[model samples]
Target: SQKIEQNSEALNIQEGKTATLTCNYTNYSPAYLQWYRQDPGRGPVFLLLIRENEKEKRKERLKVTFDTTLKQSLFHITASQPADSATYLCAPDPNSGYALNFGKGTSLLVTP
Candidate 1:
Protein backbone atom coordinates (compact mmCIF):
# COMPACT_ATOMS: atom_id res chain seq x y z
CA SER A 1 0.00 0.00 0.00
CA GLN A 2 1.04 3.62 -0.47
CA LYS A 3 2.07 5.53 2.63
CA ILE A 4 3.19 9.01 3.61
CA GLU A 5 4.40 10.34 6.94
CA GLN A 6 5.96 13.47 8.41
CA ASN A 7 8.01 14.05 11.55
CA SER A 8 4.96 13.88 13.82
CA GLU A 9 6.94 15.72 16.54
CA ALA A 10 7.25 19.36 17.52
CA LEU A 11 10.34 21.00 16.05
CA ASN A 12 11.29 23.78 18.44
CA ILE A 13 13.72 26.39 17.18
CA GLN A 14 14.84 29.95 17.78
CA GLU A 15 13.46 32.89 15.87
CA GLY A 16 15.30 34.02 12.74
CA LYS A 17 16.60 30.57 12.03
CA THR A 18 15.81 28.28 9.16
CA ALA A 19 13.37 25.51 10.01
CA THR A 20 13.65 22.25 8.14
CA LEU A 21 10.99 19.58 7.91
CA THR A 22 10.76 16.29 6.10
CA CYS A 23 8.26 13.97 4.45
CA ASN A 24 8.86 10.36 3.52
CA TYR A 25 6.84 7.85 1.58
CA THR A 26 6.68 4.30 0.38
CA ASN A 27 4.91 1.85 -1.97
CA TYR A 28 3.40 4.33 -4.43
CA SER A 29 4.23 7.07 -6.85
CA PRO A 30 2.62 10.50 -6.72
CA ALA A 31 1.99 12.90 -9.53
CA TYR A 32 2.46 16.19 -7.64
CA LEU A 33 3.37 17.39 -4.19
CA GLN A 34 1.84 20.03 -1.90
CA TRP A 35 2.66 21.62 1.42
CA TYR A 36 0.24 23.12 3.93
CA ARG A 37 0.33 24.90 7.26
CA GLN A 38 -2.13 24.20 10.03
CA ASP A 39 -2.59 25.80 13.40
CA PRO A 40 -4.04 23.96 16.33
CA GLY A 41 -7.55 22.78 15.48
CA ARG A 42 -7.62 24.71 12.22
CA GLY A 43 -7.74 23.35 8.70
CA PRO A 44 -4.58 23.37 6.65
CA VAL A 45 -3.61 26.48 4.71
CA PHE A 46 -1.97 25.93 1.34
CA LEU A 47 1.65 26.98 1.10
CA LEU A 48 3.62 25.68 -1.86
CA LEU A 49 3.33 22.86 -4.37
CA ILE A 50 5.70 21.07 -6.74
CA ARG A 51 4.92 18.59 -9.42
CA GLU A 52 6.76 15.29 -9.71
CA ASN A 53 8.66 16.53 -12.72
CA GLU A 54 9.73 19.76 -11.03
CA LYS A 55 12.96 20.10 -9.12
CA GLU A 56 12.20 22.82 -6.60
CA LYS A 57 9.57 25.47 -5.83
CA ARG A 58 9.47 28.49 -3.55
CA LYS A 59 7.35 31.26 -2.07
CA GLU A 60 8.32 34.41 -0.16
CA ARG A 61 9.29 32.68 3.09
CA LEU A 62 8.96 29.09 2.08
CA LYS A 63 10.76 26.58 -0.14
CA VAL A 64 9.89 23.05 -1.20
CA THR A 65 12.11 20.59 -2.98
CA PHE A 66 10.97 17.26 -4.30
CA ASP A 67 13.19 14.32 -5.20
CA THR A 68 11.26 11.55 -6.89
CA THR A 69 14.36 9.38 -6.96
CA LEU A 70 14.30 9.37 -3.18
CA LYS A 71 10.56 9.60 -2.92
CA GLN A 72 10.93 12.40 -0.37
CA SER A 73 10.10 16.06 0.02
CA LEU A 74 11.80 18.78 1.99
CA PHE A 75 10.17 21.91 3.39
CA HIS A 76 11.96 25.00 4.61
CA ILE A 77 10.85 28.12 6.45
CA THR A 78 13.31 30.97 6.78
CA ALA A 79 13.17 33.72 9.40
CA SER A 80 11.03 31.77 11.74
CA GLN A 81 9.08 32.97 14.78
CA PRO A 82 6.51 31.78 17.29
CA ALA A 83 3.79 33.13 15.03
CA ASP A 84 5.13 30.81 12.35
CA SER A 85 4.77 27.82 14.55
CA ALA A 86 2.23 25.33 13.31
CA THR A 87 1.85 21.85 11.98
CA TYR A 88 3.18 21.36 8.47
CA LEU A 89 1.77 18.73 6.17
CA CYS A 90 3.09 17.12 3.01
CA ALA A 91 0.52 15.99 0.49
CA PRO A 92 1.16 14.02 -2.64
CA ASP A 93 -1.27 13.90 -5.50
CA PRO A 94 -2.83 10.50 -5.24
CA ASN A 95 -3.54 10.65 -8.96
CA SER A 96 -7.18 10.04 -8.19
CA GLY A 97 -9.81 12.62 -9.10
CA TYR A 98 -9.41 14.55 -5.84
CA ALA A 99 -5.59 14.72 -6.30
CA LEU A 100 -4.46 14.83 -2.64
CA ASN A 101 -3.28 12.41 0.02
CA PHE A 102 -1.72 14.07 3.06
CA GLY A 103 0.86 12.85 5.53
CA LYS A 104 0.13 12.98 9.23
CA GLY A 105 2.11 16.25 9.76
CA THR A 106 5.03 17.82 11.65
CA SER A 107 4.64 20.46 14.33
CA LEU A 108 6.84 23.54 14.35
CA LEU A 109 7.36 25.65 17.48
CA VAL A 110 9.52 28.69 17.01
CA THR A 111 10.61 30.49 20.16
CA PRO A 112 10.80 34.26 20.39
Candidate 2:
Protein backbone atom coordinates (compact mmCIF):
# COMPACT_ATOMS: atom_id res chain seq x y z
CA SER A 1 0.00 0.00 0.00
CA GLN A 2 1.22 3.50 -0.79
CA LYS A 3 0.94 6.17 1.84
CA ILE A 4 1.87 9.85 1.88
CA GLU A 5 2.51 11.78 5.06
CA GLN A 6 2.79 15.52 5.66
CA ASN A 7 2.71 17.77 8.67
CA SER A 8 -0.88 17.84 9.90
CA GLU A 9 -0.28 20.95 11.95
CA ALA A 10 -0.46 24.42 10.53
CA LEU A 11 2.87 26.08 9.71
CA ASN A 12 3.10 29.72 10.66
CA ILE A 13 5.74 31.98 9.16
CA GLN A 14 6.34 35.68 8.92
CA GLU A 15 5.90 37.39 5.59
CA GLY A 16 8.99 37.89 3.40
CA LYS A 17 10.60 34.82 4.95
CA THR A 18 11.07 31.44 3.38
CA ALA A 19 8.76 28.57 4.32
CA THR A 20 9.67 24.95 3.97
CA LEU A 21 7.35 21.93 3.97
CA THR A 22 8.00 18.23 3.91
CA CYS A 23 6.26 15.26 2.35
CA ASN A 24 7.15 11.67 3.03
CA TYR A 25 5.95 8.45 1.52
CA THR A 26 6.18 4.76 2.30
CA ASN A 27 5.56 1.42 0.58
CA TYR A 28 6.25 2.80 -2.90
CA SER A 29 8.80 4.45 -5.11
CA PRO A 30 7.06 7.03 -7.18
CA ALA A 31 8.19 8.17 -10.59
CA TYR A 32 7.34 11.74 -9.75
CA LEU A 33 6.04 13.90 -6.94
CA GLN A 34 3.75 16.88 -7.34
CA TRP A 35 2.91 19.81 -5.10
CA TYR A 36 -0.30 21.78 -5.09
CA ARG A 37 -1.72 24.73 -3.23
CA GLN A 38 -5.37 24.83 -2.18
CA ASP A 39 -7.32 27.75 -0.90
CA PRO A 40 -10.49 27.51 1.13
CA GLY A 41 -13.41 26.03 -0.82
CA ARG A 42 -11.35 25.72 -3.97
CA GLY A 43 -9.50 23.01 -5.83
CA PRO A 44 -5.80 22.71 -5.46
CA VAL A 45 -3.67 24.71 -7.87
CA PHE A 46 -0.73 22.88 -9.38
CA LEU A 47 2.57 24.24 -8.14
CA LEU A 48 5.55 22.11 -9.02
CA LEU A 49 6.51 18.55 -9.91
CA ILE A 50 9.83 16.81 -9.59
CA ARG A 51 10.68 13.52 -11.24
CA GLU A 52 12.56 10.65 -9.69
CA ASN A 53 15.59 11.27 -11.86
CA GLU A 54 15.51 14.98 -11.14
CA LYS A 55 16.88 16.38 -7.92
CA GLU A 56 15.08 19.70 -7.75
CA LYS A 57 12.64 21.91 -9.62
CA ARG A 58 11.53 25.49 -9.31
CA LYS A 59 8.78 27.76 -10.56
CA GLU A 60 8.63 31.40 -9.73
CA ARG A 61 8.95 31.60 -5.93
CA LEU A 62 8.21 27.90 -5.42
CA LYS A 63 10.77 25.14 -5.28
CA VAL A 64 10.54 21.37 -4.86
CA THR A 65 13.02 18.61 -4.31
CA PHE A 66 12.67 14.85 -4.75
CA ASP A 67 14.75 12.24 -2.99
CA THR A 68 14.00 8.66 -3.97
CA THR A 69 16.44 7.22 -1.49
CA LEU A 70 14.76 8.94 1.43
CA LYS A 71 11.31 8.65 -0.11
CA GLN A 72 10.65 12.27 0.62
CA SER A 73 10.02 15.59 -1.07
CA LEU A 74 10.64 19.09 0.17
CA PHE A 75 8.57 22.11 -0.82
CA HIS A 76 9.84 25.62 -0.34
CA ILE A 77 8.27 29.02 -0.74
CA THR A 78 10.83 31.78 -1.09
CA ALA A 79 9.96 35.26 0.07
CA SER A 80 6.48 34.19 1.02
CA GLN A 81 3.65 36.63 1.38
CA PRO A 82 0.38 36.66 3.29
CA ALA A 83 -1.46 35.86 0.10
CA ASP A 84 0.63 32.73 -0.30
CA SER A 85 -1.03 31.19 2.75
CA ALA A 86 -2.81 27.99 1.83
CA THR A 87 -2.99 24.26 2.39
CA TYR A 88 -0.33 22.50 0.32
CA LEU A 89 -0.90 18.96 -0.90
CA CYS A 90 1.64 16.41 -2.06
CA ALA A 91 0.93 13.57 -4.47
CA PRO A 92 3.42 10.86 -5.31
CA ASP A 93 2.61 8.93 -8.45
CA PRO A 94 3.95 5.43 -8.30
CA ASN A 95 5.60 4.54 -11.61
CA SER A 96 3.15 6.88 -13.28
CA GLY A 97 0.78 3.95 -13.42
CA TYR A 98 -1.71 4.43 -10.62
CA ALA A 99 -3.99 7.33 -9.87
CA LEU A 100 -2.59 10.37 -8.11
CA ASN A 101 -3.54 10.28 -4.45
CA PHE A 102 -2.88 13.44 -2.47
CA GLY A 103 -2.00 13.66 1.18
CA LYS A 104 -4.06 15.39 3.85
CA GLY A 105 -1.93 18.49 3.25
CA THR A 106 -0.06 20.94 5.47
CA SER A 107 -1.51 24.38 5.98
CA LEU A 108 0.78 27.41 5.77
CA LEU A 109 0.01 30.74 7.33
CA VAL A 110 2.14 33.68 6.23
CA THR A 111 1.50 36.59 8.50
CA PRO A 112 2.68 40.18 8.43
Candidate 3:
Protein backbone atom coordinates (compact mmCIF):
# COMPACT_ATOMS: atom_id res chain seq x y z
CA SER A 1 0.00 0.00 0.00
CA GLN A 2 2.44 2.59 -1.23
CA LYS A 3 1.33 5.94 -2.54
CA ILE A 4 3.42 8.48 -4.43
CA GLU A 5 2.17 11.92 -5.32
CA GLN A 6 3.88 14.55 -7.41
CA ASN A 7 2.52 17.76 -8.85
CA SER A 8 0.16 16.58 -11.52
CA GLU A 9 0.03 20.08 -12.96
CA ALA A 10 2.92 21.37 -14.99
CA LEU A 11 5.33 23.57 -13.07
CA ASN A 12 5.82 26.77 -15.03
CA ILE A 13 8.86 28.88 -14.18
CA GLN A 14 11.19 31.41 -15.67
CA GLU A 15 14.58 30.35 -16.90
CA GLY A 16 17.45 30.60 -14.40
CA LYS A 17 15.16 30.01 -11.43
CA THR A 18 15.28 26.97 -9.21
CA ALA A 19 12.38 24.57 -9.23
CA THR A 20 11.45 22.37 -6.32
CA LEU A 21 9.17 19.38 -6.58
CA THR A 22 7.76 17.14 -3.90
CA CYS A 23 7.04 13.46 -3.70
CA ASN A 24 5.09 11.96 -0.85
CA TYR A 25 4.37 8.39 -0.02
CA THR A 26 2.86 6.18 2.63
CA ASN A 27 2.67 2.52 3.69
CA TYR A 28 5.90 1.58 2.00
CA SER A 29 8.81 -0.13 3.69
CA PRO A 30 11.30 1.45 1.39
CA ALA A 31 15.04 0.89 1.62
CA TYR A 32 15.89 3.46 -1.04
CA LEU A 33 14.43 6.30 -3.03
CA GLN A 34 15.34 7.56 -6.46
CA TRP A 35 14.57 10.48 -8.78
CA TYR A 36 14.22 10.42 -12.53
CA ARG A 37 13.70 12.90 -15.34
CA GLN A 38 11.52 12.09 -18.31
CA ASP A 39 10.96 14.05 -21.46
CA PRO A 40 7.66 13.85 -23.24
CA GLY A 41 7.31 10.58 -25.13
CA ARG A 42 10.58 9.34 -23.61
CA GLY A 43 11.49 6.93 -20.88
CA PRO A 44 12.58 8.21 -17.52
CA VAL A 45 16.31 8.70 -16.97
CA PHE A 46 17.65 8.12 -13.50
CA LEU A 47 18.99 11.21 -11.77
CA LEU A 48 19.60 10.53 -8.10
CA LEU A 49 19.39 7.54 -5.81
CA ILE A 50 19.35 7.73 -2.03
CA ARG A 51 19.22 4.90 0.40
CA GLU A 52 16.86 5.00 3.33
CA ASN A 53 19.85 5.74 5.50
CA GLU A 54 20.85 8.71 3.38
CA LYS A 55 19.80 12.25 4.07
CA GLU A 56 20.85 13.98 0.88
CA LYS A 57 22.45 13.47 -2.52
CA ARG A 58 23.34 15.65 -5.46
CA LYS A 59 24.42 15.44 -9.09
CA GLU A 60 25.36 18.32 -11.32
CA ARG A 61 22.49 20.81 -11.23
CA LEU A 62 20.14 18.54 -9.33
CA LYS A 63 19.80 17.88 -5.63
CA VAL A 64 17.65 15.38 -3.78
CA THR A 65 16.84 14.84 -0.16
CA PHE A 66 15.15 11.84 1.34
CA ASP A 67 13.52 11.76 4.75
CA THR A 68 12.34 8.32 5.74
CA THR A 69 10.89 9.79 8.88
CA LEU A 70 8.56 11.84 6.71
CA LYS A 71 8.29 9.27 3.94
CA GLN A 72 8.99 12.01 1.45
CA SER A 73 11.59 13.17 -1.05
CA LEU A 74 12.29 16.60 -2.43
CA PHE A 75 13.90 17.21 -5.81
CA HIS A 76 15.54 20.46 -6.82
CA ILE A 77 17.00 21.85 -10.01
CA THR A 78 19.03 25.05 -9.88
CA ALA A 79 19.60 27.61 -12.59
CA SER A 80 17.17 25.70 -14.68
CA GLN A 81 16.67 26.42 -18.36
CA PRO A 82 14.01 25.78 -20.96
CA ALA A 83 15.93 22.62 -21.78
CA ASP A 84 15.20 21.44 -18.28
CA SER A 85 11.50 21.23 -18.97
CA ALA A 86 10.43 17.65 -18.43
CA THR A 87 8.51 15.33 -16.18
CA TYR A 88 10.16 14.20 -12.98
CA LEU A 89 9.38 10.93 -11.24
CA CYS A 90 10.22 9.48 -7.83
CA ALA A 91 10.09 5.79 -7.12
CA PRO A 92 11.06 3.73 -4.11
CA ASP A 93 13.38 0.77 -4.13
CA PRO A 94 12.87 -1.60 -1.25
CA ASN A 95 16.48 -2.90 -1.46
CA SER A 96 15.68 -5.96 -3.43
CA GLY A 97 17.19 -4.71 -6.68
CA TYR A 98 13.65 -4.79 -7.91
CA ALA A 99 12.30 -2.16 -10.21
CA LEU A 100 10.74 0.86 -8.63
CA ASN A 101 7.08 1.40 -9.12
CA PHE A 102 6.77 4.96 -10.42
CA GLY A 103 4.01 7.48 -10.14
CA LYS A 104 2.94 9.84 -12.82
CA GLY A 105 5.76 12.35 -13.04
CA THR A 106 5.55 16.07 -12.29
CA SER A 107 5.87 18.14 -15.41
CA LEU A 108 8.12 21.19 -15.45
CA LEU A 109 8.00 23.94 -18.05
CA VAL A 110 10.71 26.57 -18.10
CA THR A 111 10.06 29.78 -20.02
CA PRO A 112 12.91 31.67 -21.52
Candidate 4:
Protein backbone atom coordinates (compact mmCIF):
# COMPACT_ATOMS: atom_id res chain seq x y z
CA SER A 1 0.00 0.00 0.00
CA GLN A 2 1.05 3.61 -0.59
CA LYS A 3 1.51 6.09 2.23
CA ILE A 4 1.99 9.83 2.34
CA GLU A 5 3.30 11.76 5.32
CA GLN A 6 3.65 15.41 6.30
CA ASN A 7 4.58 17.22 9.46
CA SER A 8 1.71 17.00 11.92
CA GLU A 9 2.93 19.94 13.99
CA ALA A 10 2.29 23.53 13.09
CA LEU A 11 5.09 25.67 11.67
CA ASN A 12 5.70 29.18 12.91
CA ILE A 13 7.54 31.78 10.86
CA GLN A 14 8.11 35.45 11.02
CA GLU A 15 6.44 37.57 8.43
CA GLY A 16 8.42 38.09 5.21
CA LYS A 17 10.41 34.90 5.59
CA THR A 18 10.30 31.84 3.43
CA ALA A 19 8.46 28.74 4.63
CA THR A 20 9.48 25.30 3.53
CA LEU A 21 7.24 22.22 3.82
CA THR A 22 7.84 18.63 2.95
CA CYS A 23 5.92 15.56 1.80
CA ASN A 24 7.11 11.99 1.70
CA TYR A 25 5.60 8.89 0.23
CA THR A 26 6.33 5.23 -0.01
CA ASN A 27 5.22 2.16 -1.96
CA TYR A 28 3.85 4.17 -4.86
CA SER A 29 5.13 5.79 -7.99
CA PRO A 30 2.86 8.62 -8.92
CA ALA A 31 2.78 10.40 -12.24
CA TYR A 32 2.53 13.80 -10.58
CA LEU A 33 2.29 15.62 -7.28
CA GLN A 34 0.13 18.59 -6.35
CA TRP A 35 0.26 21.16 -3.56
CA TYR A 36 -2.76 22.98 -2.16
CA ARG A 37 -3.39 25.68 0.41
CA GLN A 38 -6.45 25.62 2.67
CA ASP A 39 -7.53 28.43 4.89
CA PRO A 40 -9.74 28.01 7.93
CA GLY A 41 -13.28 26.94 7.04
CA ARG A 42 -12.51 26.95 3.32
CA GLY A 43 -11.65 24.39 0.74
CA PRO A 44 -8.13 23.93 -0.49
CA VAL A 45 -6.88 26.05 -3.35
CA PHE A 46 -4.43 24.55 -5.82
CA LEU A 47 -1.00 25.99 -5.53
CA LEU A 48 1.30 24.01 -7.78
CA LEU A 49 1.93 20.69 -9.44
CA ILE A 50 5.04 18.91 -10.66
CA ARG A 51 5.26 15.89 -12.85
CA GLU A 52 7.48 12.91 -12.21
CA ASN A 53 9.91 14.04 -14.89
CA GLU A 54 9.97 17.65 -13.76
CA LYS A 55 12.72 18.70 -11.37
CA GLU A 56 11.15 21.91 -10.19
CA LYS A 57 8.26 24.31 -10.76
CA ARG A 58 7.47 27.83 -9.63
CA LYS A 59 4.69 30.40 -9.63
CA GLU A 60 5.14 33.89 -8.27
CA ARG A 61 6.25 33.45 -4.64
CA LEU A 62 5.58 29.71 -4.58
CA LYS A 63 7.86 26.88 -5.66
CA VAL A 64 7.58 23.10 -5.73
CA THR A 65 10.04 20.33 -6.36
CA PHE A 66 9.40 16.67 -7.06
CA ASP A 67 11.99 13.92 -6.73
CA THR A 68 10.63 10.66 -8.01
CA THR A 69 13.76 8.82 -7.07
CA LEU A 70 13.51 9.92 -3.46
CA LYS A 71 9.74 9.56 -3.34
CA GLN A 72 9.44 13.01 -1.85
CA SER A 73 8.34 16.56 -2.68
CA LEU A 74 9.13 19.95 -1.27
CA PHE A 75 6.96 23.06 -1.18
CA HIS A 76 8.28 26.57 -0.60
CA ILE A 77 6.73 29.95 -0.08
CA THR A 78 9.01 32.96 -0.44
CA ALA A 79 8.56 36.26 1.32
CA SER A 80 5.59 34.76 3.06
CA GLN A 81 3.08 37.06 4.66
CA PRO A 82 0.54 36.73 7.44
CA ALA A 83 -2.04 36.08 4.80
CA ASP A 84 0.00 33.12 3.68
CA SER A 85 -0.73 31.37 6.94
CA ALA A 86 -2.70 28.25 6.18
CA THR A 87 -2.59 24.51 6.09
CA TYR A 88 -0.74 23.09 3.13
CA LEU A 89 -1.41 19.67 1.67
CA CYS A 90 0.34 17.45 -0.85
CA ALA A 91 -1.50 14.93 -2.96
CA PRO A 92 -0.03 12.50 -5.43
CA ASP A 93 -2.05 11.29 -8.38
CA PRO A 94 -2.50 7.59 -7.75
CA ASN A 95 -3.15 7.01 -11.47
CA SER A 96 -5.02 3.89 -10.41
CA GLY A 97 -8.26 5.81 -10.05
CA TYR A 98 -9.85 9.19 -10.56
CA ALA A 99 -9.67 10.15 -6.89
CA LEU A 100 -6.61 11.74 -5.34
CA ASN A 101 -5.08 10.63 -2.06
CA PHE A 102 -3.88 13.54 0.04
CA GLY A 103 -1.33 13.44 2.78
CA LYS A 104 -1.94 14.89 6.18
CA GLY A 105 -1.37 18.64 5.90
CA THR A 106 1.01 20.93 7.76
CA SER A 107 -0.25 24.15 9.24
CA LEU A 108 1.74 27.36 8.86
CA LEU A 109 1.50 30.47 10.98
CA VAL A 110 3.15 33.75 10.02
CA THR A 111 3.35 36.49 12.59
CA PRO A 112 4.37 40.13 12.34
Tell me the whole-model lDDT of each prediction, alpha carbons only: 0.89, 0.93, 0.87, 0.93
lDDT of 3 at 91: 91
Residue 5: error of model 3 in Å? Answer: 1.0
TM-score order, best first, reads 4, 2, 1, 3
Which prediction has the highest lDDT against the true structure? 4
TM-score-better candidate, 2 vs 4:
4
Off by over 4 Å in 3: 95-99
Candidate 1 lDDT, tens digit per residue, 1-112? 8899899777999999999999998875887889999999889999988998888888988889999899999999999878999999998878667747889999999999
Candidate 2 C-alpha RMSD relative to the actual structure = 1.0
Q: On residues 1-112, what C-alpha lDDT tens digit does candidate 4 reach at each position?
A: 8899998899999999999999999987899999999999999998888999899999999999999888899999999999999999999988798879899899999999
Off by over 4 Å in 2: none
Please, what's the RMSD in Å of model 3?
1.4
Name the lDDT value of residue 86 in candidate 4. 94
Please give the lDDT score for candidate 4.
Answer: 0.93
State how far residue 108 of model 3 sits from its true place (Å). Answer: 0.3
Q: Report the lDDT tens digits of candidate 2 across residue range 59-110.
A: 9999899999999999999999999999999999866565789999999999
Q: What would the per-residue lDDT of candidate 3 be over residues 1-112, giving only the tens digit for each residue?
A: 6688888888999999999999988877788888888987888998889888879888899989999888889999999999999999999874466666887889999999
Off by over 4 Å in 4: none
